[model samples]
Target: MAAVKLSGKSILALLLMYVVLIFVLQMWVGPRDRWAGYSVLTPLVAAALLPFRRTLLVGAFTLLAITGSYGFGVTGLSVGARFVVIMATALSFGISLIVCRVRLEREERVKRLMVARDRLSLLSAASSRVGGTLDVTSTARELAEVAALRFADSVTVDLFEPVLRGEDPQDLPADGCVTLRRAAHVTAVAATGRETTALRANSAGAGQNREVHVPARWLDPGRPAATRVLEGGEIGASGLPMPLPSAGTGAEGWVTAIAVPLTAGKATLGLAVFARGPGRAPFDADDLMLAEEIAMRAGVCVDNARRYTRERETSLTLQQSLLPDRPPEQQAADVATRYIPAGSQAGVGGDWFDVIPLSGARVALVVGDVVGHGVQASATMGRLRSAVRTLADIDLPPDELLTHLDDIVVKLSAESLGDHGTTPRGDIGATCLYAVYDPVSRDCTLASAGHPVPALRTPDGVCEFVDLPPGPPLGLGGLPFESVTLSLPEDSLIALYSDGLVESRHRDIDAGFKELKQVLAQHAGALEATCDNTLKVLVDDPPQDDVAVLLACTRALDASQVAVWEFARDPAVVSQAREAVSRQLSRWGLEGAVLTTELVVSELVTNAIRYGSGPVQLRLIRQKTLICEVSDGCNTAPHLRRARTYDEGGRGLFIIANVTERWGTRQSRRGKTIWTEQALAP
Candidate 1:
């Protein structure tokens, strides 16, 4: 009966025609027969076809026909039989009305069951579709498609800006005005008298559903039901859906619309508005309920996506901050670097790099990677980076710096230990490569802690990894780090990178190394360009993990810019050292600096000679700044202290500190060297 369906008016028309046919039959048969009683069939037919109200109308017409049979002067029956027939006809009409009421009630139940089954199917579809992804815009598109397929003709999804950024949204404002971004606008296609879900951004074209960012505008709470729903946190529906400001293509000719707020807990995320077109029936209460459910389901998904995006952004920011802003200004190398985080969905990893200026015109290039993702890994990277810098400040070698860093990592893991201590705390482990490049000797000293070997591109455009003694990864205590020192020619490019650049799921580590070499082999002119092009070739749009690269072009000081002299352990060499320094300054055309250089040479040479050591040595280097260094075999290092006014001997070291821009002492295998740097005029 449901398959061959009819509206109330159609059923009423059929009943009315049945009544007319019964009247025709009464007229055709003579009054001699009780054929007028055949009109009773009309009421029975009406019971199956029409509602109680229209059934009563049909029965009334049948009653008129039965009684009007008397107009034909019925002499075929006596008055008692006529009255009995009239009574039976009246009784039959009353019974038909009761039957009509019961039948209508049962049909109403069946319709409600069908409606419930469809709603369940729709909600199930929504749960499987909209709830699968933790992406805000994708969820919005799925909701729009599911809602518009059968229940609505057009659907619009709008969300708060912060929620789109993956943060919890603020409560609706007191004035009910809130900023919203149009996340999706989907319209259904009506074809072949059937509706199915195919997402359409506009009737002009169709494409993948992406986040829609139009000019930012406030939703008007007083009108245009989208905002009204957000204000009241309820569904807004009317005979004709309100016109949306940004409604597109298939949204026209809509006769029905409903706006529902997407709310989770006490916070309202945004709004969803659904519409129906001219050909479709106007929305009923059941549709309004279903729209609410869809909006509610979408709210939960958007909230989840919002939280995820917020955490990822925070982690990336922290990770970048923990890393370098730009390589510091240093003369040891011309530096350029690049850092790219994993894609939006994949969490941020702990990949970091730093360039630290070491003593004696040297630069330490450090790159490291931790095992995990998120804030913890980034924080650990920061801690290790800071530890490396602190050790470098004390003039530790590359191997010793990594050695201390390993101890720090071990301590960190030990501190995070749980009651069952088999697993190190946070599952912390890291791989690091530390390299120190000296412009004076043109030698790059490198050490590794289970890290990938760095690549070196020669000035002649040859690329190869500078292999070293690969040590155990940090956190496995008691492993000694080994240092490798190799000669780097001038203008050679040294690349320090995290394992992310050379580790892929589709290929082995060797393949990634081959690609890295290929990229570095064909050099771009600028270090910045080379770094960028390297990433473009090796990195995905959103890389699977964090990638960090640090590149430096080597520079060597010319022999003409440096002077070294060795003298016996005698106070007489101090004056000779001052004369030699004056001549060297004159040769370098730095004649103006001769007097101050003489004073610095005299003070430092005198200290090295009288400090009770073996032979004394003096070395002067000219780069961005003029460096004066004096060394000896004395195990004792000098201290700059306040000398008494009457004391002349102790003032030698103090005067050197006052005359130079900066001064410090570093211990070498030969002894200790007290070095001073004075600024040279630009």
Candidate 2:
């Protein structure tokens, strides 16, 4: 309805009906009787209509009608009639004034409740939405979107890191519709506990920008506080100035802003702000309070998510670095090494095993487990492994090498023990095994320090753990370790494993070893396949701990299959070797490579007779690769160097080096073997 028309018509119509009603009432009912009832009814009706202007107007008209007709327009009236009319009008006006006051209070209360509900709802949503997220950037984006949807017309988030001083501000997203760098905004919010905003007019006109600063009235700058405040720690309040309808331009265009502090555990994490241009609806105290609640919950969720993300990233990187792109190729006796970290932690570990070539025709085999996992364990494993190689190069016996390692551990523990003062036992301790094997003699010597015994699986499918005296664990001294010697029969397979393979929580060490033996027995025959199958049995699915396994087999060529020809220091020796090669070549029915072998054999025998030792032995074997070995008591090893045009003596080694596809020298305590290999006939 038009305000002017409704007001004028309502007043005129009301006045006209007032006269008519009073006149009729006075004539029909005695004025003396009506005064008391009219007096009571007028003020009661006026008071009932304290909230609505329409109710007030209608009630006033009714009162005037009754009073005017009964007191003035009627044929006869008593003294009480005038008193009733005057008192009724006065009471109606007084009630109308009181109603106006009450209406204002009710409106304010409703606005406050709505604002409070909005703030509460926003906080509740933020808590539930971001609590478990593991990515910080994604969480920031989510918070920004939630803030925009809940509080203001638009929202943006920028992460400010003061420690990272070299960052570019332009790269950051705009925050809360304000044109401020993210780093700058973070500084501002942190310093003042306030949010900056650009005012928006309405939901449709929210695009307009009007820069404004909110006061940090809720925070005390001098008081020390944590980064977050716990829920219910602080009460929140908000206020927004109302604009007059008739006010124009600058004076009337006052913007409204609301703020809620995001707090957890007595500290504020951040702040959320809502704002709009002039002519927008004003915010109530409850809005700011509700915002604070939402902020508090959001703060906790963000912190958790960030921590989770950091740990996940670090673990992933460490795991990748620990794992090799591919395992080492098949070594002596067809060895394959497969390493898998515990899937749960995704961290690097110190579990390692290796098949290292020794000075003689032996392999120095080892498998060890460090006390822990992750970056520290990985680094320690690297150091220990290097030490093992160094000790091996020095020709230290297995037992002596282990003793040296124990000494190193003792020193390391003593030096670093003070760092771990909180723990009763400081620093990590390791378990290790060192073994040396000679394929020729089929002899294996092993030493252990608190490590599980290596198992031997014979060609006939018999499996048994090696029996050895237990020694003290590394880093702790109680008893000295002694080497154990075992005859590894030809075609026998030996397996070394870390305790993680068989040691389950429910079983003791002996039971674990028994389990390993049972697993080996189940998968016998194929050495490589059995090793893999045994590992699978011991590991099962979802292994609770880390596992490392190394397996090797001994193969000895029979005397009939391998022929050795010995010669003395004489020209006849070279002729003898040539005749022997020719006879073998003819017997084997070989022709093309046979001449090359004879020439190589004659030249090697000539050199051995001329410049070398007490005795020389030439052995030929029909194996996977053609094996031709020359052994001499001379400790001096022969080298094939780049021969000059005038060089004659080094030509023998040069020819041998060229003919051999694969060759190596092994120095033993007694003598050294210079073995050269030719590819087998198809």
Candidate 3:
């Protein structure tokens, strides 16, 4: 229950009644009568109107008035009356003292309650202001600002270097010296008026704003109270003599300071220092306890942010390692690519692109996206990219390549279900687009597995999306994928991209396509320029998903750069094939390569006629490398094996491999094409 307060009017009335009673008692019964004891009420009433000290003064004055009335004999009194007046005076003085003590105790209790309320308010503010972000720097700055505004006139936060880098804390030095990086510093505007000179000096030569270094012995366990607090993960107070590099010369105005350790679990990450200027009361026990609470809360937030940062960096590194370092160079097209990962908060996504060089002067352009983010998605992307390259090397058509990829994804999903006993949602799903451009035929064949269609820009700067059938995304079985073939003019631009470039929350896929077409038409100068301009116009902020874009400008080989011939199924045509190859080389001014070319043609034709069927053909093309191809009507592919010194039957393909830079066989509609490439003369 609340204490009842006496009004000024009531208190005055009580004092007057006490005086009247004294006068009436003295007038009716002598001044020293036994009823004079009632005058003690005068001093008790005064205690309600005045403070403890003033109440004592009023009690002394009333006692003197009683003694004077008896000493002057203002009324006839016996010895007993004198004794009664003395007793009443003594009782009033003692009772007034008791009343003053009670009032003082009540006032002290109210002050404590107010202090407790303020501390609770500070703790609430700390919880709301700090740890609101996963960024270490931002969290530290917020902690400092809140402390300075609510608890102290100035605040500074310092963290170990490894802690700032999202690493676990190391053991403290045995020699009592510690190294710390100043992370945040904030002061009350009214208290500091301007930036401190020491802060300015510390930041003058620092490379980053919050990375100033401070060396101090105060962090040692035995140095001072503040140091003890840090070493023990407790709270301690200190004077200005302690080393505080963050405060610098501004420490002169700091009359009292408290240091609390920022600890997460068993590790100590840093320290928070709160300081009060002159004229402010020094931090008491309650203040130190409150500071410790704030530090503990902020510590957990900082540690959580650090852990998140570390995980993000790890994911990014894994994704980057999985991506191709550089696109392969091919004769059919010039390729340029761009890849940007999502922000740290969004984590890393599985977006990848590749340029694979195929046989017959054909180049494969690929862009793919995995459904989720983080290391698992990146690992899946790597596996899929490897599978695609392997399939492309075997000369699979674009549609067949995607079919094989879909089978792999379905197998992966099944394996995941077997391992975890639950079907994953969107985890194993992926989208991809594969395109093969043949310069010899001046045609491109493309296929999509639930991926966006590519954009094509003609030599005249007109852009449009390729109309292709969209198949089910990878990981879904029993789906048929179809391929679309289009004839592109020489110098035409073809762009393959992941959906991140054309889809966002605010824009639909069709709107994204329109913007892409506009950008491509506006900047159609070079492959690299087109890629840069497309990303610049399409991505104004950090995309929600990873982005991968690949641009290639097509170039076709003219009729003069190629030669073709058809031969009968007779073994006698081997010599005819060699003669045709030599004449073609001479006409193309590759006379220096004629002798080796004749040998290569002789071995290839002799084998095709000996082990193969009828209707053999031969072709040669001039590009970055001179390519010689032999096709037969048989489905069998020849292999290269080491021939015994005593045997001559299995040395034809071996001899071709040694005389040329490289050789391979690819299956064609009719049979297989055995091809060899030799480096052109410098």
Evaluated with TM-score, which candidate comes out highest?
3
In order of lDDT, best first, we have 3, 1, 2
What does candidate 3's lDDT look like per residue over 135-200, in tens digits? 776788778877764577667777877877777766766553466666776655443545344333
Worst 10 residues of 2 by lDDT: 183-192
**Candidate 3: stretches off by over 4 Å:** 1-121, 191-252, 414-426, 505-510, 645-648
**Each prediction's whole-model lDDT (CA):** 0.77, 0.59, 0.78
Candidate 2 residue spans exceeding 4 A from truth? 1-338, 343-347, 356-364, 382-430, 436-440, 459-461, 469-483, 526-544, 553-561, 569-571, 585-590, 638-655, 680-682
Model 3: which residue pairs collide? Answer: 32-81
Q: Give the top-scoring candidate (lDDT).
A: 3
Structure candidate 1, residue pairs in collision: 166-306
Error of 3 at 44 (Å): 12
TM-score list, all predictions: 0.77, 0.51, 0.78
What 10-residue stretch in candidate 3 is worst by lDDT?
Answer: 231-240
Ranking by TM-score: 3, 1, 2
Q: Cα lDDT of model 2 overall? A: 0.59
Q: Point out the higher-scoring one by lDDT: 1 or 2.
A: 1
Question: So what's the TM-score on candidate 3?
Answer: 0.78
